[model samples]
Each structure stands twice: as structure tokens, then as C-alpha cells.
Target: MHKFHKSIFREYDIRGVVNETLYPTDAYHIGRRYGTLVDSRLGGKKICVGYDGRLSSPALAAELIRGLKDSGMDVVELGLGPTPMVYYSVFELDADGGIMITGSHNPPSHNGFKIMLGKDSLFGAEIAGLEKITEYKEGFGSVTKLNIKTRYIMRLLQDCIIEDGYKIGWDPGNGASGEIVQKLCKALPGKHFLINEKIDGKFPAHHPDPTIPENLEQLAELVSKNKLDVGFAFDGDGDRLGIIDEKGDIIWGDQLLAILAQEVLAENPGATIIADVKSSRLFEEEVSRLGGKPLIWKTGHSLIKTKMKEMQAPLAGEMSAHIFFADKYYGFDDGIYAALRFLNIMQNSGKTASELLRALPRYYSSLEYRIPCKESDKLKIISDLKNALKVKKASFSDIDGVRVNYEDSWWLLRASNTGNYLVARFEAKTEKKLAELEATLSGFLAEYGYFLEV
Candidate 1:
């Protein structure tokens, strides 16, 4: 009934439009196959399941759970919650693994599963492997559903709040986060303002992602309008954070990681901080300035999480708002946890968000530019662009995409792993250097035959 093949499965996770690439029967089959795989890999023989606020999430989660349980894997249904809550349930329950049904920041039609195997990100090829077991049409198992929301809530409150309370703003964007924000607010002693708290599958207010400046515009307004210290926005699934200061600036994902790592390194001297190539060079510099080692890793929550576990890094982040803290928590990316940590940092740092940004100046940066393309042509563009850059002898690293570092600035061009777009970022020390970096982009675009408006 399901198209059991690699087409639906992707590098980071399993994702596709509902009824097209991902159907209910497909979800059921994938669940069974996953259960079989878990049986062989993790002896715990149990799984935690959670879903986002997507239109198709409930059906997908139900059928997916049926598949997992049909393969003899016990299921703990976490109901509708953010992806981070599902991840937290996995770690706290001491289960073998878990799956968060989420489209992430994709459009309303998209939905997928964020996989975890023995507490590590089961992504890329690992996710692609879902087809192997389903090819044989594995046996069905039983699902025992148990609500774990309370346990999950308590885990978030565990040793999270700092000594002093702080005022804050929370915008769930009418997504799944509202399910728990009410419970979470009970533990924190702060004057909190919540917006779009309704768990609407349509995401009527705005796209559930905070990383995109356009998506976070409301939270920025909420901060200044409420006279709050800061505002926090979560993606549809709650694994990514979009932060807004009282002054209405989106304190990007990389910057938030820097702020968190600064707190971490003071306690654990010279600890490693991992960040994606999309992050500014200043992230590395800041980590080093604080006597911590910074490693530039590829972009993607799953990739960063795996690398964080491998390197045992205290902190890891992507510019898109996926921040991981291995030093104090279970190390998987959790936007809610990251928000709490930011508040804790504020309590300790004794500086407002605007003041912190004013003080931590280094380079002028451009927002991530997403250039659309056919998914089929994405790899070809990367290859062609790589060749073009090679002819110029411009120094570059394919760490995530092509990060060509220059004297005063750097430009990184890479294809998105999850979607059909070439994401690029540029940073420079001066306005002149910025233009130069932007100029280099046009040449690469022309060579690749991809018209990108800078």
C-alpha cells in the first residue's frame, strides 16, 4: 500500500507531501520496518512517539505507531507536542529510541519523522535504510499507548531555571508548542506573554519557524510591544528557536549558541563548541576567545546532533536555530531547553539582549538566502559551482557546502539537504568586503546557470 523505497526517505529524515511521497499506509509500513530495526539494534524494545501541528500529523503518527508496534516495539504515544518534547521523552524514558513526526519549517503540506536510534540521530543514510526492511513487508506488532506529557514537562523543568526570575515573551505561532507552554509556565517565576498559543495545524499567524526573519517579525513586535526583556519563537515542531530582543532584532541561531557556549565554557574550560558552516567566523572566534575549541560542522539538526555526540562537544548549533547542549542536558537539540538556558544566561550575565549585541560586535552578516531549484538539479549545481570555484583558486571548504574564506570576508554556497534550494551566506568585516563577497556569488550563479538575486 505504501511506496517502500528511498524516494520518500531523505538525508536528514523521512519527509514528503501528504498523500504523495508520504501516505498513511506508507507510514504504517515504515513503522513496522523501524520496529524490526529497533529490535535488532536496541534491546529496550520500546519507542516514544510524538507529532507536530501539521494537517497530516495525526494520521501519520497513528499509522506510524501502528507499524512500530506491529513489529513488536512497545509504543509510548506522547500525544501532540513539539519535536523537542518527543526527544526529551526518548531520553527521559530511557527508551531505545523515538520518532518525532514533524515537517519542521516546511510548508503546511509537508510532514516527516525525526528518527533517533539509541539516543543518536538516525538520519541521512540511516533514514534512507528504512526501505530495506519494508521491502520484505515485515510483520505487524501491537502498540500500547501511554501519555508521557507530565514526565516530559518535569524533565524540562529539571534544574533549568536560574537563581533569579526574568520577564519573557513566547510566541508558539499557533503550532504544537502551546500544548506544553501552559505547563512550562507554571514552573518558571516570570511575567510571561504568550501569543498564537492555539495549536492550529494551519499555522494561521505565521510559518512556525523562527529562523527566517520574516517568520519571526511578529515575535520581534511582541517583545517591544509588551516591553518584555526578550521574545522566543519555536518552529512548528519546537526543535528550533527564533529569539527576539527587546529592541526587535532576531538574535540568530548562531548568536544564541554563542551566548550559551560562553556560559558553558566558563565552567568547562576549553570545551569544544560545534557549529555549522552557515555560522559566522565569529562563532569560532568567540569560542576560542573563551578558551573553547570550535568546530565547523555541516548544517542540519540531525547532523549536528550526531557530531556533538561524537565529539562530546558541550554545545552545537546551526544558523537555522537548532542548538544542542551536551554539557548540561541530554545533548539532543531542544528549542525549549535552549530558551530556558537563554533566560538563565540573562539572569547570570546581567545584560539585556540589545546590550549584549551592542557589546558582542564583530562582523556584518547577511541572512541565509534560499534560492529555489529542482530537487533533481541540486547536486548538479553543487558540482558545477564547486568546479567554478576551483578554477579561481579561491580557498574553500566543503565542510557543509562551499565555504570560500577570503581576507576580509567569506561566502558559503551549499545545497539544502532537506529541500530543493541552494542556501548561501556571506559575512564581511566592512561594507566594501561585503560587496566583494556578493560579487563572487553572481559569478558562481552564472556558471551554475542558477539566477540568484543577492
Candidate 2:
């Protein structure tokens, strides 16, 4: 007999290293517990289950379904696909809730569960509540199969009028996205020059995440070599987007937010735009210049979604490329949908991608440099830095992390929600100003035995 442990259930979702802390028995228990959670809240007996491209995902999803079925909740297995595909199935099929077996952009050895309830992301106390049900788990239900990916592909294709003659570049990054990119492209009106199109959990082509500049190399090459219009890359589970322009410029998420913001404002003037605290300050400025309200809040996806609903914002995005669009589509992070929306924007403007971006005022910034710390010490390090930097002369904001605002530059240090790392970004009006900000923070960090590194 296996007993459910409390340590595995975490703040955002359930995660652990495969075969070490995570196992089929544990997954079965989680499914039962989660199924019971569903039964209590929604009273619907059906749940849509899905997974990613990892070798363990299929087995984990199967065991998860077994538990759900055992708990008397009807299980609709959608097999391997991106997280957004699972969300689409849950909504289209009218599932009570859904659980996606994906590690997201985590390391290869890690796997986790992302659960959705009644069309909302479950997190914080809601995610923690799973343990209470696991203590006395018994409810299990019926299981079935549905090839919903075809419907999903057709829907994406139908939603847009793509240019069939255009040559576009794609970097799937060997994640779950490759499994369906070709199928979905049939509806797309362009030729795809794909890089890392194979679905390999080992991530031989580079990590699936496109947010990092290094990961954009291959896709950038393809864009320049073939003279493609645009390039797009998917994260491990394909919820986040990474975009490269025809000029091979690796657009930051905030920059992309600005690009999409142009299209969004054209449709609805004076709408609210929400972005994470780590986002570029330029985004907020542009929002105002374009006649939209800008709101900066915390960084997590769950938090952003909740804030979006609370503020009734039409569009939201994070530095990680998790875009939520309540403007015309479901307000969830769908990288594929985001990519198409980018194209739609380009088509409407009749502007080349580079020309569109060139319209924005230029500013230089550093990549989000991660400072590694032990899981136990990360929080303390933040606290120490916060106390040390708090002075009568300095202005700071703590929306998520500490954002020190100087006269000519700013630096933000926030702990990552999904990993044991500190995310830092610095920007300035000039190279000299940026160096001053970096030097100041570097001194503070050095005293604590950790220094900022690019």
C-alpha cells in the first residue's frame, strides 16, 4: 500500500523527478484525489486527460486516467499534445476539468501535473487542497479515448486566413509540439521550414524554450537563410512562445507584447493591458501612447490569469511569453494561437515584420540572468538583499520581487516561481547608466557571497 505524501504537492502544481519522487502509484493516487476534488466542486463526472512528448508522459497519463476512472469520473484521454491542446479539449468536449502531464520547460528528468478546474487554473491553496483528499482516496470512474487534436488543428486553421505562398520558419525544440505541427500546418497558408521537428524528450536540438537567446540560434539561422517572414519556437509543453522576425531579431516577450498590443488596441481602444513586473517599461509607455491602460502585477501564470479576470483586462503577457488574450479568444496561454495572431497582425497592417517593429522607440536591455541558489536558501538571499538595499535615498517596488528605481535606470530581482533561481533584469537610458546599476547590485550581492552574472 502506497501513501500519499504532502511534500510532492506544491504551490503552483505537482512536480518531481521521474521514477525517484514520482511514480505510477503516486500518480494514480493523485488522479483519484484530483478526481474527487473535481467531483466535489463541479459535480461533473467527466475529465479530459492529456500529456506531453516525454517518454514517461504516456504512462503517467495512463495511470492518471486509471485513477480518475476508478474514482467514478469519466476520463477522456487525448493522448500526447501541448498543454493548450488539452485546454481546448476540456472546453470543446465540456469536460468537468482537465489534467496535463507535462514538465513544462523544466529539466528532462522532471515531470509534473498541471490541473484545471471548471475552466480556471487551480493554484495556491487550491493545489495544496489535493492532499486533504488523498488521505482518504477511493473515488474512481470511467475511461474513454478521443482524438481531439484533429478538431483542434482544423479550428486553428479555420480561425485564420494564412498566406499559403509565404515561407515561415518553425522551431519545435523536440517537444510535444512536433507531434502535431505538421498536421496543424495543413490549415496554415505558408511553407514551414522546421528546425528540431522531432519529438525527443532528451531535447537533442536544445531545450524547447525559446525565451533564452541561445535557444533562438537555429531558428534565427533558418529565418535569415531562407528569407522567411517570421520564426516561432515552442517551449517544452508549447504553452509559451518565442518569436524571431524576418531580420532574425529575437524579440523579447515584452517586445512581442508591444507588437500584439498594436493589433489589440486597433480593435478595442482604451482597453487595459496587463504585464508582469519583469516586463519592459517600454511596454507600459506604449500602452498609454496607444490609448490603453497599463497594469503591472506579479509574474506567475495563475496569478496573471486571476488578475486578468479581476481587472477584466483584454490582454496580458509575461516575460516568459505566456500570453493571455481575453480580447477574442480564450484567455489562456496558447502559443500556437499567439503565433497565428502575430501573422494576422502582420497581414492587417500590410507592414513587413521588421518595419512594424522599427516603428517602436529603441532601447537596449540585458537578458534575464539567473542567479542559482539552493532551494532552501533562495528566499533568505532575497530577504537579505532587500534589507541591505532599502535606504532613504533609493526607491523600490515589491510587486513580485524588488525593483530598484534609479533616476536613469532600474534593476529587478525576483525569485522564479517554478524553479530555485533568482531572475534579474536591468535596463538604462545609456550603457553607462546600466553599468552603474549593475555595479551597485554586484557590490550588494558580493557581500552576501553571490554576485550578479550575465
lDDT of 1: 0.82
lDDT string, candidate 2, 1-454, tens digits: 4565545677678888888878878888888888778777877778888899887888888888888887788888888889999888877888788999999987788898988997888898998877666353356467788888888887666557556566888888999888678777766777888878788989998977788889999999999999999899999998899988999887788888888998888888999999998888888878999999999999988899889999888899999999888887778888888888888888888887787778775666777888876677777777876776774556888888798876656899888776777888898888888887788877877776777874
lDDT of 1 by residue, 1-454 (tens): 3455446688888888887777888888878778878877765577889898888999999898888766777788888888888788777878888998988878899888888887888987777777766443345455666777787778777757565456788988877788788778877787888888888888899888787788888887878887889899988888888889888887888888788887899989988899999998888878888899999998888888878878888889989888888876888888888888888778778998877666565798988888887888887877877787799887889877788888778998888887778888899999888878888787767765777687
Q: What lDDT would candidate 2 get against the real structure?
A: 0.83
Task: Look at candidate 1 and tell me the lDDT of residue 248.
Answer: 89
Q: Work out the TM-score per prediction.
A: 0.95, 0.95
Off by over 4 Å in 2: 1-7, 134-137, 388-390
